[model samples]
Target: MLRTLWKHVAADLTLAAPLLRLHFHDCFVRGCDASVLLDSTANNTAEKDSPPDLTLGGFNVIDEIKTELEKACPGVVSCADIVALAARDSVSFQYKRLLWKVLLGRRDGTISRASEVIANLPPPYFNFTQLKQSFSSKGLTVHDLVVLSGAHTIGNSHCPSFDNRLYNFTGKGDQDPSLSPPYAAYLKTQCKSLSDDTTQLEMDPGSSLSFDNHYYKLLLQHEGLFESDAALLTHKTSLNEVKKMLISRNFFAEFGQSMRRMGNVQVLTGTEGEIRKKCSVVN
Candidate 1:
C-alpha cells in the first residue's frame, strides 16, 4: 500500500523536496514523532502553523499514505514512521541510487507547539557557529552538517529566506560581500525588493531538480542561497567537507548516513508515544 501510494504521488516531481523537508523539520523539533504534522486548535497553535513551517508543503501526500495504512492495518503504522518512509521514498525515487533504510517503530507525538519551531529549527540566516551549535545540540557532527546540507541541491526557497543577503546585509542596505557578485545581481533582479515574499529561487540554480553535489559546487563558487549555506565555507573543517562532497559518489553515501543519524534524533519507541490515527490530530 505504501509503495502504490508513493508511485502515484511521486509523479508530482516537486513533492520529494518538501517531504524531505517535512521529515527534517518534524525530527528536529520533537524527535521524529510527527509533531510538525499536527494542526492548531482553538486553544493552541501547532508547529505546522509556525512561521518557519508555513511554507512546508506535501502534507496531503502524508495524509494519503496515512489513510491507506490505517485502512490496511488499523493502528499498526504510526504517522511518524510514515513521515520517515515518505521522506526516504521521495528522495530515493528522485536520486535513484541514493537510498537509505529508514528505521521505523517511531510513534506520533501528542504535543505540537508553534512556539518551539523557531528555537529548534535552524534558520536560513544562521552563521557557521550557530549552524554548528544547532546541529551539535541534536547530537549531529560537523560532517553531518556538511553532508546533510547537500539536500539543498534540490529545493526552491522563497525570497524572504535569502533576501537580506541580496538587499540588506548589515541593516545598511548592502549586499552580502561573500555572495558572488554576478549571482547577487541576478538575484536582485528576480527578488525585486527586500519585502518581496512571493518570488522563489531555486537553491541550486540550474540543477534545482537534481539531488546531487551541485549545491556543493555552488557553495565553492560563493553562490549558496542562504547564510547558513555560505556558513559552511566560513570554517576550515566544514569548508573541507564541502570540498569532499563535490564528489557525487561520496556525497550520496554520506548524505544517507547523515539522514539516518538525523532520523534518530529524540525518537520515541517501545510504547513511549501513541500511533496517531490521523496525522493532523491526536488520537
Candidate 2:
C-alpha cells in the first residue's frame, strides 16, 4: 500500500517533508504516541491545532495508510506504528531505498493538548543552549540533534518560522550577524516581513525537495534558514559534526541511527496505551 501511495502522493516530493515533520512533532511532544494526530474536541484543544503544528500536512497520507491497514487486519496496527513507518518510508523517496528499520508495537495516547506543543518541541529561534536542553530533555544526544536536523534538507518552513533572522534579529531592526548577508538579503525578498505567514520558504534553499547533505553544506556557509539551524554552529561539538556530515558518505547511516534513537523517546508500550481504530480520535 505504501508503495502504491509513494507512486501517487509521495511522487510530488513536497508531501514527504510534512510526513517527516509530522513524525518529529508527534514524537517530541508525546513520545511517538500519535497524540499529535488527535483532533481537538469542542472543550479541549489538541496539539494538531497549536500554532507550531498548524503548518503540519500529510495527514491524508497517514489516514489512507491506516484505512488500508484496518481492512487487512482490524484493530491490529497502532497509529503510533503507522506514524513511525510513514516517517521512515518518506525518506526512502530520496534514496530509492529504506534508510532504517522502524520498530513497531507503539500505541496511541488518549490525551492531546495544544499547551504541550510549545514547551516540548524546540522552536526555530532556539539558541544552541536552548536546543541542547530541549533534545536532552527527550533523552536525545547532541549528535542526534545535529543529525536529525538534517531532515530540514527536504522541508518547507513558513515565513514566520524564520523571518526574525531576515527582518528583525534583535528587535532593533538589525539582522542576525550569524546570517550570511547575501542569503539574508535574498530571504528578506522572499519573506518580506514577520507578518507574512502565508509565504513558504525552502528550508534547504535550492534543494528543498531532495534529501541530501546540502543542508549541512549550506549550514557551514551560514546560510541556514532558522536561528536554530545557525545555532548548530554555536557549539564546538555540534560544529564539528556539521563539518563531518558535509563530506561524510556515512551520513545516511548516521541519520538512520539517530532517527531510530529519536523514535524511542519516552515511548509508551506493553499495554500502556491503546491502538486507536482511527488516528484522529480515541477508539
Looking at candidate 2, the ten consecutive residues that score lowest on lDDT are: 2-11
RMSD of each: 1.2, 1.1
The lDDT for every candidate, in the order shown, is 0.90, 0.88
List model 1 lDDT by residue over 100-129, tens digit each. Answer: 888878988999999999999999999999
Candidate 2 local accuracy as lDDT? Answer: 0.88
- In candidate 1, stretches whose alpha carbon ends up further than 4 angstroms from where it belongs are 95-98
Clashing pairs in 1: none
TM-score of each: 0.97, 0.97
Winning candidate number (lDDT): 1
lDDT by residue (tens digit), candidate 2, 1-283: 5685577444577877888889999999979899999999999999999999988988888898899889999988999888888888877876778879888888889999999999899999999999999999999989999999999999788888888777778898888999999998899888888789899888888888888889998999999988999999999999999988877576787999998888998788888989889999998
Candidate 1: worst-modelled 10 consecutive residues by lDDT: 1-10
lDDT at position 11, candidate 1:
76
Candidate 1 versus truth, CA RMSD in Å, comes to 1.2
